[model samples]
Target: MLKPILKLLALCAFCWAFFASADVLTVRQDAPERYVVKKGDTLWDISALYLSEPWRWPQLWRMNPQIDNPHLIFPGDVLKLVYGPDGRPMLVRDNRVVRLSPRTRVTDTRPDAVTTLPLAMIRPFLTHDKLMTAEQLNGQPYILGASSNVKNATEGHILYARGELEPGKGYAIYRRGKAYIDPETKDELGHELNLVATSRAFRAGNAANNEPASLQVMDARREIRQGDVVLPSIDGEALPAYFHMSRPELAVEGLIIDTTSNLREFSKWDIVIINRGTNEQLQPGNMLNIVRPSPTVVDGNDGKPVYLEDSSRYQRLARNFGHEQITMPREMVGHLMVFKVADRASYAIVTDTFRPVRVGDHIISP
Candidate 1:
């Protein structure tokens, strides 16, 4: 009798802790009982209607077995919120097929399901932008010269390249951008390859005979110049439209190394590259919180402290000359979701911003 009583107490404690952990999924008081999924509604937008923190959507979907895969929620489906037997909120989807006729009946319309984010915002990065290693960039075919010795060529111009080139094949022209270096260790990560133009090989180069290949520029976003790299057109991976939003299982942290627009400061929806990637156990759909390191303060003689932002160059250096300095607490500025991961770095778009973010800002697992 004593053993049975203890077992029941242990189970009760375990159940209590399990439900208590979900307190963060606070449902809004004005949340509707049921909502009709719309054509343009995103998973993030829909989740924000019911929970305060929309990033915690995986928790809400887990309680309800009806929503096996959140990505499959169609536009015409109906979402109904109901409580489970354990008194936890569950979001249930009603995707019943509507019959149009008895003999020739219509099934459920499975149109393009709503993605987690606006695909238009990230489609270009997914297709064009890429990171290349130093060796890879150096080995690719380069524009040796242009027909008629044109210094800068546009569309429909013939250019000659000297490398192993294939005839009748499409190639993407790229200009070398900045080199990504780890902020902490100062190790060279990779070089940013900016897509400039695209072309097709009119004639293959023969390295054995020292013959250069002929290429005709098909499309030009910018003027194609000599020394521009020519590589096979990047047919990027087939990534899913909807990303499974989740935190990293391991503690991961890094600094923002670069931005797509080359802006000094970035905010929501801006694409930025971080120093961490698959090497750091980061992957697509991992959300990280951005933290801005606090500036150091110098204590002056007049019973006041001057922040580094307000201090002069001389005053900032005076900290080494017996001036007391204090480092303030770091602040959380925003959150970013990793959309693409390379070997040593990853591309992430700012999902939420509470303050202005800059390069070198720390990104930690949420």
Candidate 2:
């Protein structure tokens, strides 16, 4: 059911570029020499057994050109860690189908595979309208004046929209989630848009005649309201359950602006928004390391706060000022991969979390 991912036209090339690794990665000391693929075994699962940093699977997996795409990954396949001619570690006798197969694709040989994360964890975010800025929402088709005279309407309610609507077509109702900003630069990234409901056009509107369209709400998570943005209905069929893991073409250093659930203890499988995106040459499947920033602590010995930076300056004035800021090391708190990228923001899910991801967390090379 996974087509060539053409649906992501904006990033089809970048998405497909995920088939290979850009760098040589490190392997875990306790990693097994061989692993057999099993049903329900994700790429992340298999990669974890071999690499210290599991997100670098692309590097170790760069062995066989065939297995790069990984959509064809199947159970019962044997994988062994063997060195290549260059004396670097790589998988041996592994059949990996990188995204692009220049030769004729032989569908008869491979098995269908799922993604690194559970589908339920990311299904809600697989839409085009997840990130919307105020400027982008301007003049967008919206609910005319609310579904009805009532304050809020639920399922089976009739709604009206003030924009061009095609007869028999469908549209989705969405509300803003959070105002995301760049943690480093303090620039507004964009607003997270949530799909509130979906409706079908029983009637169509004409811009020339200023005629409004009527729609019957088919589903509603909450209330559909006036001024709510109405966009093309999300096509469930177009969603890609399989996301090939790849490394970023460029160095990615940014901050976690927000979490999807806004929990202080951000755990695994949680969706998040970072401050990097297409502007930084990022694309879907690019892996990242969620670096937790160290807190500044006061220097107890001198009775002054230890300054992490300006050590020489502190050394010169320490006896006189009794104050120094101590810099802490950034820890590898979690791992994530970009699934969708907007102009200035991206949506990624935490693949693994050693600690809770918070706002302003560092995102560096994986």
Query: Top TM-score: which candidate number?
Result: 1
* Positional deviation of residue 158's Cα in model 1 after best superposition, in angstroms: 3.6
Candidates in order, TM-scores: namely 0.77, 0.74
Off by over 4 Å in 1: 1-40, 62-69, 72-78, 94-112, 236-239, 295-324
User: What would the per-residue lDDT of candidate 2 be over residues 1-366, giving only the tens digit for each residue?
Assistant: 335565566476665555434345667788888787787777777777887677656567674765645545667777788877876787654555336547755553443563566666777777544886678888888887645587677788888888887878888899877788876777788888888898888788887899888888888988877778888885664567566676798998998887878687787778888888998999888889989768755463655454445345546456456554466788989888898888899999888888877777889875
**Candidate 1 lDDT by residue in tens digits, 214-234:** 998899999888898888996
Shift of residue 28 alpha carbon in model 1, Å: 4.8
- Let me know the TM-score candidate 2 reaches against the reference structure: 0.74
Provide the lowest-lDDT 10-residue window in model 2.
Answer: 106-115
